[model samples]
Target: MEPFKVHILGCGSAVPTNHHRPSSQVVEVRGKFFMVDCGEGTQLNLRNCRVSFSKLQAVFISHMHGDHCFGLLGMISTFGLTGRTTPLHVYAPADYATLFERQMDYFCKRRDFEVVFHPVDTTRHMVIFEDRSLRVESIPLEHRLPCCGYLFREQPSLPHIRRDMIDFYHIPICYINNIKNGAGWETPEGEKVPHERLVTPAAPPRSYAYCSDTRYIPTLHELLKDVSTLYHESTYTSHEADKAALYYHSTGEQAAQVAKAANVGKLLLGHYSARYHEENQLLKEAKSIFPNVYLTDEGMVFDV
Candidate 1:
């Protein structure tokens, strides 16, 4: 099925630790790449993971927190230094545009390419972007500051070519392309070849949801329903649920509850608090609620 994939570049929270970096992730779908957040050292993480920045079509910032966006200025400057002329689209809260522009001015380096910003509504849920093969939606979340989660859903592709029927009918290469594109073909002799007879349905489209730096919010369940993969912040243990609420972060068990409630196929828990010397406890606690829970570390890639 060639399922789309997501890579966790960095997965720490406000404070970086020797074991974890700040928030950064890359979601690749339909042969394109979209980066979520750009915490400190994100570019290094990308290079370490062997993901080329040239492939990134967009960046979605969940919020303006330092852990979520401190690396953005550096990435933008690096892009300019590399002579990147390709326009970069960034979806973020309205205040981020001003913040970035101010930082750029302070650096005195004008970008070589256009930087378009799409301001997302942190209080409402909506499908904010769509291309031929995918749709990106913004799901509001509860955080200390305004934030919005991102949901990526790939659109179903055209049916696959039926090799047996194509061989049997001696279909021309041009006609085969048409069949794979969901179009029926008619021979010069006026004989119609139905697409169903020449092709099989493509694999079901998959979805990946990203929720970062947010407190446990049950309203998000419906928005993330049935997602193939979910990446949620687990900033602390269940024992620290009080601290999680006080700090507007999530405990491992709370993240698991969201995944179970949403019926997400798999869960990748990241954004760990620096206090944790080991992550095994977080995984154990989350897995108790959602069996498919996986602890995400820097450079971990998963097929969605």
Candidate 2:
């Protein structure tokens, strides 16, 4: 429960507008930050939002699109200049490995920290990253280029220890961890104290899904089933359905359908086209289909 949240850095499409930037967001799970899509000015956004640069563990790029990854080199260079020593992990399509290496060699020479690249398939659903408290999985998406989304799932925490039981039984502090791990305690009088009596069940884990720059792909529903919150691209309104299909992008209506199919707790609409001065039309269209849709704006934060 330690801030399972998303901070929207940018939410515009390919073209940058005075109002919105490209695609970028920071997902914080249990106090650790994972950046998704480092669009232009993402580092500046991070600084403006007061996110600690040293706490950013990794960056996940949805595709090779400039709108999604153009800021990566700049961010890396900035990190180098700031004298960061921790290794920075970047996950992107396998095809970007060569390009990334070339850019790093030319711009990031003799850096203090290492840039670790993790090549993603972009065509399969797999657990790409895991820690003690959370896991990140790649969710294949339909796009003009090879692209994928990311699913962040929080690992279930240990059950709450029963203070009354511990106090009554005089259980040693050292044995608390064992009890939390489902071990029963044996009393000195040869009595068995079951773990069930020492701890309560843990709360269910929560999950968030980020589906950016993808068309309406039905297959994605299965991967996103029952997610706590979903951030899906809504680059156009229902009126531009034809254009959306032609460009392999999603309309607001399509994004809502995906959220409805997946039965998510809430749907966040983002990646808006610059053409619209206001997102009311897109929000209206999506809400007509799925009532729980929310619009994304720069600097907006959502707790999941």
Candidate 2: tens digits of C-alpha lDDT, residues 175-236: 89989998998888999988898999987899999998888887679899999999999999
TM-score of model 1 (CA atoms): 0.92
lDDT of each: 0.87, 0.93
Residue 112 error for model 2, in Å?
0.6
List residue ranges in candidate 1 displaced over 4 A: 169-173, 181-194
Best by lDDT: 2
Most accurate candidate by TM-score: 2
Error of 2 at 223 (Å): 0.3
Per-residue lDDT over 1-304 for candidate 1, one digit per residue giving the tens place of the 0 to 100 score: 6649998899888876888898999998877889999998899998888877777889999999998898887887888888788988989997777877777788726877877878888888899999997999998888889998999999988888888877777778876676777787666688888878888887778999999978999777999989999999898998999999998889889999999999999999999888988899999999999999898888889999
Off by over 4 Å in 2: 188-191
Query: All predictions: root-mean-square deviation over Cα?
Result: 2.2, 1.2
Residue 232 of candidate 1: its Cα lDDT?
90
